[model samples]
Target: MRRTLDEFNDRRWIDKDGYQYVATRLGEAIASGIEDLIERVETERKLRSVWQWLPDAISAFPFETWSDLTITVAEPDAPYRPVGRFESLLRETTTVRFLRPEVALMDLCFDLLYQLIAEGVEMRLIDRPECHRYFLSTYPNRSSEMIRQDHFTILEHDNLPSYGTGLLDDCVTISCYERDSGTVHALIDTDAPAVREWAESLYETHRADARRVELQKSAESVPHD
Candidate 1:
């Protein structure tokens, strides 16, 4: 304890008066800075596993919004936590827009998705060609049915980030996937307007560059025996 106090004194962070040491202004400032740094580090550690799968645009989000961000991570006992969160979002939304790189997130939600479409929810999706192909093969009847709906639209982008983005009603979500397995590992969502605006701009940029998919054309592109 003596050596630690001496080190603090040497750094001018503390002053000794008649054997009683008190923290100086510099000490308080340093302590506050260290507290913030530790908090940021902890947040990073929590996101480390899925960090690489998050959208690069997330870095531009205001730092203050990080605390307000809601993170739902999948757990061993509840492996479908993130998916359940997404489904709940789906059930309540009147509008849905997404940039999807993989189909895993939506694969299990096909029934709900189709029901939403039938209920006249406006939905637009920008996804990779391979993802569309896979979905068509996996759910031929439902895929065909949904695409024919006026309320649903599909656009194909050859390249997309590993992570997925969604603008569901007023909420914005970033879905992080496992690196090798391609299953959703976590979801980071926020209702912050600034974050939602950023997501909207990103979605528009990708949508503008993507090509609309024609149902017959897409189905024909898939190989058959």
Candidate 2:
């Protein structure tokens, strides 16, 4: 389910704008599920989020339980660094692909990626050219080393949109995110096979079209000063 649907469906709760409405079982279940997930995903570091509005203590979710993970981060929510769940997902997934330009370059997230790469996880990162410039600059050496040992690929895009995602192993659990009140919203789903398929298929198209990122200084060799 995309955020658009939620925004539209949620409006049904209040026929009058901004008016509070009673919660139904389905609505409560959805809210409860979100809280439980945030608790698990944020297990520690205790990141306060809207998803954690419920009173119960959060539960810890193991990464191994998910066969796939797809993450989308709105630009507004790209800066804040999240702990726990991501670490687990990074460690568990044999293959991870990223589409968020800003988040992909953040140290909080990418710094932890080295360990996964060292452990033989394949990570394919895609982002806009400007955002990925720093990455491509220092990538040649590392790419040479890891490409042979593990799957390490970076692609350059010129005009990617605000919405972005990461498709993990097989297309099982896909995580969705947005922003409100300087906090990031989260959604992790395992039941949406159709969504998973669409995400993977979208990534495939990008993969087919994605070009290797590289830097070329000049066509002619620089003359001695």
Candidate 3:
């Protein structure tokens, strides 16, 4: 300890300010460092919860106790697209509020529709206008024709956020934007009451102003080419 102090002094690390720093609140500083270390360890453990390093991998609320849920994403794409396990969550769920930007029509048209419809679950799709012509050029077969407003509404994308949000009944999922790789979307799924309420409020507030989609009117009947 004496040698270490001598070395610190020699390196000018133990200056007058440094001495003051240790004298003033040395115990508190030590405690804070330990706390930070513990937090890092806990964070590392949570990150390893899932095989994939998603942003929202931890959930405070026990999944077994929750009922129906909701999900939201800042941009158009949903992280759930790559998550096949997400389908299991939808099986028993009745109503799901999918608040997001324009999604790939193929992703929602058949598989999602079939799962939700088969379960007789109410799946609300809230997004801006998706260019049907754009889908036609890249992908064939217009599956978006299957989206019926009878089950839900299509709200115009308004006040989009930078981060992704998901409200799963009691739990919530959040992710930050990664400009480098879209696949490496970080997730932070939690069941904190405050988070759930906040997410729900954001959805309800804009939902009032969202444009209600009339499926028949939104699309023009075109002969199969």
Ranking of predictions according to lDDT: 1, 2, 3
Local accuracy of candidate 1 as per-residue lDDT tens digits, 139-181: 7777877888888999998877778899998699899898789
Off by over 4 Å in 3: 1-40, 44-82, 101-110, 131-146, 175-184, 220-225
RMSD of 2: 14.5
lDDT of 3 by residue, 1-225 (tens): 878666655655554463452322554565588887786566555444332433232244334312222332233565554233344444545666755523332243446655555556666655545533333333333434345435644455556554445444445555444544533233455456756776787778767777765544434453344
Best candidate according to TM-score: 1
- The Cα error of candidate 1 at residue 51, in Å, is 3.2
The residue-by-residue lDDT of candidate 2 on 82-201, one tens digit each, is 333455556667887876535432334555676678877887877776655544344545434444553777777765544455677654333333433423344343434555555676
The lDDT per prediction is 0.84, 0.50, 0.48
Candidate 1 accuracy as lDDT: 0.84
Inter-residue clash pairs, candidate 1: none
Instruction: Give per-model CA RMSD.
Output: 5.2, 14.5, 10.9
Give the TM-score (vs. native) of candidate 3.
0.53
- Cα lDDT for residue 63, model 1? 69
Q: For model 2, name the residue pairs that clash.
A: none
Can you tell me which runs of candidate 1 are displaced by over 4 Å? 1-49, 217-225
